[model samples]
Target: MSADLTHVDTWLFDLDNTLYPVESGFMKQAEARMTQFVAKTTGLPMDEAYELQKTYFRDYGLTLHGLMEHHGVDPDEYHAIFHDISLDALAHDTDLLAALQRLPGRRLIFTNADDRHAERVLERLGLSALFDDVFHIGSFGFLPKPDPAAFDRMVEAHGMAPAATAFFEDSERNLEPAAGLGMTTVLVGAHAQDSHASFVHHRTDKLAPFLATARLKEAA
Candidate 1:
């Protein structure tokens, strides 16, 4: 079905891969820290930690969740160690800033990462001022995206009408809950899937260009 792309009063965007280009290498550094932490904490080899991390991320909403449940790892420590990386490689995108400004609505960030991490990235990318608020994983008691409970909590807390909101995310699984709630789900990233299996309502590799048509397209 062709998306109507109208009546979006709230623009919810995911951090990390959604707000910034996935190829920025920030996530690569974070993932490396995660692997290293997992290996050190679980007494596993680096290769084993790598596979386990992926499995945990697949099975749980996030790798940190799995580590907490299975290994009793503290979420705070996980965030501190993994999210402490430098963002020297991330470049500010003026087009994205302009596009975001053009999109008429209350722009908010919905991220699985912690508050500090989200702040760091947004600060580095020069996009921190664009968002009104950022609801991080900690706000939902460490539960990440794709969890209906977390979504419901956020919706209720913000008094957000799911039908009038548009959520842009990089992970296909994360979009499922938003779509289920009648929110328009836009898959963002270079490798975003347009498969029928996905619940995504739209797909865009370039966020700035896609958002450039935001008001006009939705106003149609």
Candidate 2:
């Protein structure tokens, strides 16, 4: 917000941890499901499955991508199992909702998650109607973020000018590609300060308050 974001006309947000606080335990549920899928598919023990899941995430940016590349897992099957998470721990974030409503211009979700998961998460957070579009993993043909190609596809598909866009993400690595494409990159979550990466234009442990500080552009 203090970084001269007045030129931003398109807001691209990552779902999951970016929208809801990680402390909410919602992602823990999805991660547990991911471990279960890995165990059942690969016949690995629960403990080892958890480790492999983490490795896949570390290497591929998405566990599903690693599974598809190494195990030939079907994308649809993986998505269905991995995202069948309970939202009991997620509370409605009225502050985030208000901030998004205040921001003028196109608002879109750019997530590694599939559309179904994205929609459900937004609906749970009372932000379902606020977004103009969702560019999910399917939209990128299973290529997820941190990959420069994914950023290019999103920009091309949405007809957005990277310089006029601002992307918010929870992962510091993911913001690197956005910055490379000339977009304003804001890192959200507890580890935001841990990153000394020059690519991160802004950092905030709390997204709603950071967004609240955003200055609107005046009419020409």
Candidate 3:
């Protein structure tokens, strides 16, 4: 709606599944890398490592955060191993990139993944230059999202007014705090149906349609 765009001067997008569809198979490879990393780091069996990684992701907002807090794992080492997997499984979506370019105002990436991974993915999509900035888990003292502190730091670092920014993420849980901060929230991809995102302001299965709607609202 027009009301939504009135307060949104900046657009924050999530990387990974939010940028492209999950069907691309990039996530599958990434997940495999994460599982292997967990297995090697924890010295657990592959199956157990997978379960533990999932548990950490479920308990802590991110597996890396949980690994760091409880397992004493090195963040940089973990990130390097976990996110260094091949991105060849991902396909380019030029239409999405074009749609994003047409949107008005500053656009940035706010991802839970480390900056290195974000850069690689964006570059693969031909969208590396489209973003005004990239904020990653490493940006704010390694604190991952769903933590209000991370969002606050992002606001301060970018000199963004809470009411003038819109955050788009695939994870529903991450949207609530941003919404609480007074930013317009857009939940992207299939996870938009997740119950954790009940407070999100908008939901879209694809980025193009959402950007189109936002542009229309801005015009109105």
Question: Which one is best on TM-score?
Answer: 2
TM-score of each: 0.94, 0.95, 0.91
* Residue lDDT tens for model 1, 169-219: 888889999999999989898877554545788888878888776544443
Q: Pick the candidate with the highest lDDT.
A: 2
lDDT of 3 at 132: 91
Better of 1 and 3 by TM-score: 1
Indicate the residue-level lDDT of 185 in model 3. 86
What is the C-alpha lDDT profile of model 2 across 1-220, one tens digit per residue? 2556788889999998999988898888888889999999999999999999999899989999999999999999988875667778877888988888878789999999998998888888889899999999999989878888999999999999999899999999999999999999999999898889999999999998888777866431
Tell me how far candidate 2 lies from the true structure as C-alpha RMSD in angstroms.
1.7
Q: Which residue pairs in candidate 1 have backbone atoms (N, alpha carbon, C) closer than 3 angstroms, thus clashing?
A: none
Count of steric clashes across candidates, in order:
0, 0, 0
Question: Superposing all C-alpha atoms, what RMSD in Å does each candidate have to the true structure?
Answer: 2.3, 1.7, 2.4
| Residue 212 CA displacement from its true place in model 3, Å | 2.3
The order of the candidates by TM-score, greatest first, is 2, 1, 3
